[model samples]
Target: MGVRYLFQIGDQIVYPMHGAGIIESIEDKEIQGKVHQYYVLQLPNKMQVMLPVGKIKNFSIRKVVDTLTLENVLHLFHNGETDRTLNFKERYKSNMEKMKTGKIQEGAEVLRDLMRMNKEKTLNSSEKSMLGNARKFLSSELGLINGITEDQAIDLLNYRIGK
Candidate 1:
């Protein structure tokens, strides 16, 4: 028997490390002689992914945040502070783990901390790439939730974080 998916076609979901996307379809495919259910997601960046329904829980796939949660995520910028004393490797690892959570608030923290770090000192190439990924992921979700363009979402985040 194939695993059932909680999400239906047209539902909006956030795939950690991949950003937000709409569920384009659910299909059954035979792999290794066994039939499995998959969710076909179309990302905002025009990327598509096929995720096995049985592995959904392991991936942290989730629905988009509601307006109130979005508000709280925005407010995190005002209340959160980055600890600059931590070593670069340690900070990067921590931020990467947070990004993997697929939570809007966690993504906000990663972006905020990285932005602050950038102002204090130049980041290494890995840090710069992580910053870009976090920003893109956050902006994608923000755009979907607020009905704004990705560029507009980036602008709003920049304004909120005082960039």
Candidate 2:
């Protein structure tokens, strides 16, 4: 199975679109006479979010990246650039989808692309928001993995990206 049940109780994980949360417990419950297994999650940053087990994959929840992987993801921001789009709505939708996918590497791509486009011209509101979200998400995960504050992680990433 792609989903691992080995996430320790109380360990923090990133659910990409949902940001950071802790795995509260693994529970076996019955719903409509069916036995359901779940990885109960408590979102520390979000209010009253208790996630069920079977839906974790559908929810895009995964363990946070390791320090080495986080380093490589930061390095990606300086490597490749994406083609800019003329349609603001389309670009926003595409970048939002990427951000929701829970792949740090892809988030780096969106960040790099948006920054490049921003330098060429001022971004529309949607694009600007997406850029901010991508940067925040990446930095938050980096913070969790590196044991640093979110602002520190963002500063380190910006310095590495030479932004």
Candidate 3:
């Protein structure tokens, strides 16, 4: 398959399970005697990842949302639906699947549901971690989209979500 590069250096993108990041560089590296182009991203968690250009399509890599979509995504904080019927294990599995989708909207929904659950009763340790990661992912993307720091985006999310 022909390589199709979707993002350039400095472009903001989401690298699922790792939150959002900026494309730091596009470099050709020799791995196991084969040269391939890789996208090196500077992640929000202070991590860097090198993904192969040709294999990016195998993942759910996508550009960040525009301002209009950002508004709608943040809206989920207030109006998103929650699933409170599942047992603890089932709920955790379900939320993991949603987070894997790498969609900001879905992540927001997960955050919303988890927050609501915490309001009713304290979340378990695993869920608390998931909630923190989800919040980070959402806030990172928001920061990149609106040109604010992740802390500021988090503040905005909290303000909008009434946290």
lDDT of 2 by residue, 103-156 (tens): 888888888888888888998887888888877777777777777777897897
All models: lDDT?
0.89, 0.75, 0.87
TM-score of every model versus the real structure: 0.93, 0.78, 0.93
lDDT of 1 by residue, 1-163 (tens): 9545689899989999989988999989999999988999998878899999888889999999888998888887778877878898889899999999998889889988888888888999999999999999998998898888788988987886788
**What residue pairs clash in candidate 1, if any at all?**
none
Model 3 regions lying over 4 Å from their true place: 1-4
Number of clashing residue pairs, candidate 1 = 0
Show model 2 residue runs off by greater than 4 Å.
Answer: 1-6, 25-48
How do these models rank on lDDT, best leading?
Answer: 1, 3, 2
RMSD of each: 1.9, 3.7, 2.0
Better of 2 and 3 by lDDT: 3
Model 2 pairs in collision: 38-53, 39-53
